[model samples]
Every structure is written in structure tokens, then in C-alpha cells.
Target chain A: MLGIDDPLIWGVYILCILSMILCVVYGLINWNRGEEAEVQEIAEEEAWEEEEEKMQSEELGL
Target chain B: MDLMILNLVILVYLLATLYLGYRGWKATKDSEGYMVAGRKTHPYIMAMSYGATFISTSAIVGFGGTAAKFGMGLLWLTFLNIFVGIFIAFVIYGKATRKMGHNLNAMTFPELLGRRFESRFIQVASGLVIFLGMPLYASVVLIGAARFLETTLAINFDLALLVYSVIIAAYVIWGGLRGVMYTDAMQGTIMFLGMAVLLFETYSRLGGVTLAHQALTNMAPLVPADLAAMGHTGWTSMPVLGSPWWWTLVSTIVLGVGIGVLAMPQLVVRFMTVKSNRELNRGVLVGGIFILMMTGVAFAVGALSNVFFLNTRGMIATAVESNVDSIIPVYINATMPEWFIYVFMLTLLAAAMSTSSSQFHTQGTAIGRDIYETLTGQKGGRSILLTRIGVSTAVIMAVILGYYLPGNVIARGTAVFFGLCAAAFLPMYTLGLFWRRTTRAGASAGLIGGTLVTVFMYLFVHKAESAPLGIAKMVLGRDVLITQMPWPVVDPMLIALPISLVLTVLVSLITRPPPERHLDLCFRGMKKG
Candidate 1:
């Protein structure tokens, strides 16, 4: 198809481009899907960070 | 090349890199920030860092040279790199890893595995493996870049090695992961642009894509007699099926590095850097395109370099340079303009630095967090300070090895690390994430057993590594334990990974499952609720 005789060679060559396009479409579709969950997760993450900090300081006898 | 012009360009680039490093240092507030960029990195930064760290100078110059010799068959590796390395990795593995790493507050790849299975032994052992094995890989990368500078700028090799190591060590030690990622993003952009231009120029010069490929295909009869004996068919075709060349291409290069990317410690930690699945989703787009441009173009241009050489020099690329490693560089010097040479130099510099920076970071964390803290039972604020010290130590070790190690080790160093990571880590890592029933005993057995098997194969069975290493020759009086044709050529990862996977599953079935409460904690928020 791309002037190469072997199907396997040209097959993978085309698959590389197709796989990249798949990534683009997947990204655009899922860009905004999990945003709300991220906000709540951030709050939990902050709490965990504070806990981690406290533990480290305690170990240091601060 | 104009020395003054090149120096000005490099000076400006280094200054910009230092500025980004300064920004990372200013932003780092705690150990978490140093380790995982505080788990709030922008999707673009995370994706670029991951891609840049994955595609090194070896991938471009080394593997690209192999493509030039072997033909377009190496494109299969590029396909696997994008589809598996980016798409499946970000979608399937990244989400699970990020959630679990957050739940466990895991800071490094080893720590992620350690906390998951509740096995300090696993963490410390994995850390030791990385600390010991990674220096060779890092040193090889260091040597590749230093050699380029030495040849291009007429600098002394020793001075180039010292200066390059010091530049990378400065930023990585001070700013940590944030510094690494920011620099990686900028470097990745340069790599993308460089490869894009090379591909465009090659195709246009060769009368577009189809004609260039057709020209190479028609030149099939010109295949050297020696290469044809080993299964060289044509530039646009796969090697003759079931031949020695086909096995090396399919088993070693394509499958070895292809599936091995899943288990690389430096790359796996990148999954933990982003905020959520949304960031990973966005990262997929950037990472896919970045890898496509980086490796896809390198492989394509590499094979097409034959066409360019034929038109200009009336000989094939291999005829021009007996050493395949020099094919890309020699081709560029012969064909590209002066300005493009400067740009390509930066591209090679960026590729080397980005990969080396990540290696140093991962090695340092392996020593500080995985080995030191786990062994000594110390988790105080001092560990981050120790990690910086570790980073410095890693840089010094790599520099020393670059000076000492023989030149031939560079090609084998990368494959050894990748094969080791796959056999040692992949089975346990994959099962630990998805199977709540995976036991600590099973994980441990897989980890240790897989490592031993891979080492044994390298020492005895794999002719490519063993013949050069010569441990088998000294001790056992054989170049390779098996002199059989295909058996000697098969990669250790192909043998060890399946054994490791079965060992994990069977042992887990026989042993007690991990605590349910811990399993719940690890798996929490992994699925979209």
C-alpha cells in the first residue's frame, strides 16, 4: 500500500498512525469526564499530605 | 560547523534549562514535591516527561542504526511503543497506580510495591537491584552524549563527560522530580521538532514517501551476501521468516523492549505523578504523538537514509560506515545543512539528558526511600536530604563508569536493564495491581526467581551478552551453554517473564491471600464509582 511489498511491514506502518489517532480521540472524549472527582480527591490528598507532614515532624522530634 | 555559533546556541539552551530548574526548586515545599511533584503535575508536563525519558539517544541513534541495517521491520517496535507504552499504559495501568499510590502514600516505584503487598523485603530487594543495575545504563547514556560533543565540538572527552554530568546533577539534586519533568518537557519539544524536520526533509528529498520506499525495495538484490545469509530480504520488507535475523528482530528487539516498557521503574513512577485519570487521559494524547514523532520518524528516516546515501555517495549506508551505530550521525553530517546540524545536536543532547535525569532520580530514590528508610526503619525529614546526597552519589558513579567501562558495553547495557526489569518486576507488578488475592509470598518468589533466571540466562545461555561477558567461558569452558542456533539468540525476557507470571499465580493460589482490609485500601477509588 505504501510502496512496500510485504503486508506485515506496511501493516504495522499504518497501525502506528491509526494508534496515534485513537489516542487523540480518546483524549478529547474523556477530557472533562472525571474533573469533579478530581476536586474531591484533592481535598483528601491535602488531608493525607498534612498527616504525612505531622508524622515526619514527630519522628524528627520537632 | 561554526564553533562560535554552536557555543552561543548551547549556552542559551543551558541557561533556559537552569531557569526551569530554579522554578522547580522554588516550588518544592516538601519531600512529596521532590518525589512525585506533589502529585499535582500538569498533564502536559507529565506526558512529555514520560515520553522524553523513554526515548533516549540510544533509541534514536542505536536502534535507528539497527533499522538502517535491518530494514523497516523495526517499525513493529515503534508500533508497540505507542500502543502499549502509551495507550494501554496510561489507560489500564496509570489509573490503578495513581489511585493506589495515593491511597498508600507511596513515593517511589519500589515503595508502591512494598506498601501494596506489605513486604519490606520486596521494597528493599527491588531497591538494591535498581541501585546496582542502573549505573551501567546511566553510564552508557553519559558516554553516548559525551562522544557526540567530543566529535562535534572538538572538546576533550574527559572534559565533556565531567561537564555534562555536573550540569545534569546540579538540577536533579536541587529541584528533584519537578526539575526533571520541567526540563524533560522542554527537551521533548525539541526532540519532536527535530525528528519532524528530519522526516519531512528525507521524504521530500527522496521524491516523497512512496517513491523513496519503492526505490529501497527495488534495491533488494543489492543486499550484501553476508547479511542475506542471516536473512536480509529488503529495506521495505521484513527479514526472511524463521531465520536468525527474524528471531533477533521479533524476539529480542521488538518483543524484548516492546513489552519490557511496562515494567521499567523510571517509567512506572511517572504514572504516579499526575492528579487523576483525567490527567492521564490527556497525557495519552500528548504521549502517543510524542512517541510517534520520536521513534516512528527515527526508524523511517533510518531506513530511508539508504536511499539518500545511494543517491549521493553511490553506496548504501552500511557501505559508507561499517559500524551501524554511526549510520545516523554520518548520514546527517553528509546530507543536512549547517543550521539543521545545530538543531539535531540539541535534539541528541535533550534525548540523552532527559533519560539520564530520570535514571538518576530513580536510582537516588531507590537508595534513599527504598533501601535506607526501609532497612533502618527511618522515615524522618532527613530522608529527603539523604536522597539529594544519593543523587550526587549516582552522578559520580555514572561518570566514573563512563570513564572505566569499555565502549562495547553501551549497546548491551540498555537491553540488560530492560530485560531485568521485565523479568523481575512485571509479573509481580501486574498481579499486585489487579488481583486482590496476590500473596506476599507469591510476589516475593516471582521477584527473586525471575531475577535469578534472567541472570543465569545472561551468564550462560544468551550468546549476545554471554560471549562478551565471558563469565561462562572462564568458568564453564563454553561461549554459550547452548550452541544451538535459535536458542542462543532468544532474549532472556522471553523465557523468564512467562515463568515469573506462572510462579506468581501458582504460588499465590497455594499461599494465604493478603489481608482483606489492606486489599480494600489498596483498591479503593481505583474504579470509577
Candidate 2:
């Protein structure tokens, strides 16, 4: 407790390092896994989106 | 000893740069290729360019000077740059931005947000903000380059300003954004090598870092009377609590730049250039490591400069001018071995030019995409050509403005560039990316409100001592009214960001929710699996 540095500083450093390691681990583990959770799924919605896209493509005539 | 030879070497560097950029002109045909290098820039080069452009002459010069004056305290900002600015930026922000960009088929920051929101109005407004704000930022960068050239080459600062701007313009006009990236890579390399070398050379010159550190510690009592009175302790020290230095470091350096990185348009657009999250993830490591080195080295050298000054002049550099910004350039020129001046010169030129080129390219695009594109309409190739012309016009305007600007050019310029980016871009950017309920009404109101308030605050409130007490003084306080506010009133970003965020959320809640389809499309449509 009476050492040359603050325990708070060392504690923050340890936490930051641990957090960084966990983040890296998560990224690697999830790399080969399937879909991202951030995205919402809609099998029905995709058909409508696809249909709209087709309509727009026809209208623009790419 | 001859300044002319140094000048000639600089000219050769300029010639080589222009030639390379013109070669790149062949690569730039469409907006995609012109803007983001066809989204295929390699991770290493992109990482270097990102690092190079981010660590400007201002960071090296101004922050170094600050380090010399303040000590190792400034190192915290560099850590933040690596962790938050680079690591978080790439993994968290970069992955999301790249995925969304590919989804929306967008080229610019404004385009990305506009496409995400399904609103051309947002794009146009964002573009307008960039056009209006980027030049001040660019000019700030230009002033930094000019100041270094002025001191080193012993020439008219105006001539240095003109020459530096022209080189940046030529490369940008010819290669577009790709050229900027190319030079940024080279500059980034030189910066890394230069900082590493400078670190070694400075340590050797000081007998060793530990010795230099002890000297600093022992010499604290010997601090210049004025600095001590002003609460400046030493390089190995910090300012007294509740002093100008403390506020400047805490609020300005840490908070100002720490949060400001997220909102910078030039940096934001960088995300759209990578291929995928894989590239982003890989590049983030490189960017983080590079930032760690670049910023770590700059502050290390800066802290040591005080020792260099005392050994040489027997006075702190700031004691000579009250402005601590000049400390780095002076210390480097004096202490480094004779042969290294050329290398140091090249190092600074690379740093300044890389940032300057990026600034010009981004500013030009802002004009083409935001202002001209809005008034005139894209209309195909005409839009492309107009955008090119806009790049040149913006560069010219910056050059002219740079030539005439007064005050401590470097400090003022950095304040302008970083300040403008903070005020005009940050608020809307953060909200646009993170705040889902962000409405167009809120977005536009935030954009205009943030920009105008920030600018008005900077010009009238910050400068009230020189100008009149524009509203803020009467409303805020007498100290602020007279430019005696002790600290800057309107960093613009701080105020704008809050207003923009609050307005965005409030308006989003009140307004009709976005079509929902676009939200689905933007947030989740990309099922790459």
C-alpha cells in the first residue's frame, strides 16, 4: 500500500489489459461463427426488400 | 549550414510527390476509386496512412511543446488515441462503418449517413457542414507546416505556406484521395523511423533517459520564475491544481481530442476504405501499435526537450515566448546531431504534408459532395469534374487565407482546424452512428445549430478581448466576455455534440419513425454468412 505507485493506477492497467484480451478472444471465437446479433432477421421482410430492389432496378434500368 | 541545400532537398521531395500523384491520376476515374481507392487499400498502407494523417505536425510540434512545458502528463492522450481512437475505432466503429458503407454503396461520410437514414436532406446538410468547416481545419494544418518551415529554413513564412499548400494541392488534384493515402503511407513510415531514431539520439544526447529524468527532477526548483508563478512546474512535473495549464491539459488535450477523434470526417471516411471487418480488425492492431509509437515517442521527446533547453539556453523555451508551442522545433534543431537536421526536416515535412493532403482532399469532396452537389445536382460526370474543381478551389482558398493569417500561426491554425471539426462535424456524426432515433429534423437542427453556435462562440466569445462581447459575454460571464474566460468557451464540439444528441433523440422520438425498412437494411441487412 505504501509502495512507489498508486494501486488505482495498477488496477486500471490490469482491468484495461484484461478487457483487451477478452475482446480479442471474443473476436477470434466469433470469427467463424454464423450471423451477427446486431442484425435483425426477417425471412418475409427479405422477399419484400428483394421485390422492391427488383422494381427499382427495372425502373432505373442498370 | 546552407539553407538553400535544405530548400532544394525539400523541392525534390515535392517533385517526387507530384510525379507519384500524377501517376495515381490514372487510377482515379469513378467516385469510388477517387474517394476510397476502390475499397482495396491494403491493411498495412491504410494503417500507416491513418496513423500518419492522425499524428500531424501540430501533435508533434504543439503537443511536444506542451510536453516540454507540462512533462509526461500529456502521455495519457496518446494512450487514449491508441485504445479508444485506434482500437475501438477499428473494431467497433470501423467494422460497423465498413459493413454499412458496402450495404449503402456510399463513398463519403455524408453519403453514408444519408443512405442509412434514407434521406438526401441529411446528406446535403452534412455535406454543407463539411464544406463550410473543413477549410478552417485545413488552414490550421497549413499554418502548422508553414511555422515549421519558417523557423527551420529561415524564410518568409508566407512563402513556406504557399509552397506547402501547392504541393498538397497537386498531389490531391492528380491522385485524389488515393494519392493522399499513398503519401500518407510513406510519411507514416518516415514518422515511425524518425521518432524511433529521435528517441535514441535524444537519449544519447542527454547521457541517458534516466539521467535526463533525474536532471529534470533535481531542476524542478530551478523552474523559470514566470513559469513557476504561472504554475508551470517542469517537464517531469504537472501544473498546480486550478491553473491555466491544468485546465488546458485536462479539458483541451484530454477531453477535446479524446472525444473529438470519433467525429472527424477525414478519419470517419477512412473506415469506408477497407474491404471488410477482417481488414479492419487486422488494421486496427497496426494502427494502435503505430499510434502507440508515434504519440509515445513525441511526448517522450517533448518531455526531454526541457532538459535539452536548460542544457543549452539555461532557460525554458516557453520562458522566451510565453507560447510553449515553439519548444519542439527549437529543441530538435539545437540538440540533434548536425547531420540529423535534414532527416528531422524530412520527418516534419512528411508529418505536415500527409495531414495537409488529407485535409485538402476531404475539404474538396465536402465542396463537391455537399455544396455543389446540392445546388447543382450530381448529374453524373459533371458531378465528378465539379468535385475535382472544388478540390482545387478549396486548396487555393486555404493557401490564400494561410498567407495572410496572423497571430501564433501554428496554435491558431490547430485551434481553427480541430475546433471547426469539433463544432461542425462531431455532434451529428456521433448521433448519426449511435443514436438510432436520430431524425432528419433533429439532424439538420443539430448540424446548423452546432456549427453556428460553435463558430459564433469561437469568433465572438473566445475573441471578445480583441472583438466585441458577442452575447456569450453578457450571458455567460464578464471573464468570458473579455476573452478572459480562463478557458475556451466554445470548442464547438462539446456544445454542438450535446445539442445535436439531445435534439436528435427528442426529434426522433416525436417524429414518425424512419421507414423501418431502411433501419433493417442499415443495421442488420448484411447477412454475409
Worst 10 residues of 1 chain B by lDDT: B30-39
Candidate 2, DockQ score (0 to 1): 0.07
Tell me how each candidate scores on DockQ against the true complex.
Answer: 0.45, 0.07
Q: Pick the DockQ winner.
A: 1
> What C-alpha lDDT, on a 0 to 100 scale, does residue A36 get in candidate 1?
38
Q: Residues B285-311, candidate 2, lDDT per residue (tens digit)?
A: 567667766777777777777667778
* B3-116: candidate 1 lDDT, tens digit per residue: 777787878888987897666555655445332455566778878888888888778877777788888999999999999999989999888887888888886899999999
Q: Work out the TM-score per prediction.
A: 0.91, 0.80
For candidate 1, the per-residue lDDT at B79 reads: 95
Among the numbered candidates, top lDDT falls to 1
**Residue clash pairs of candidate 1:** none
Sum up the clashes in candidate 2. Answer: 3
Off by over 4 Å in 1: A36-40, A47-62, B18-42, B154-159, B174-176, B381-389, B404-411
TM-score of 1: 0.91
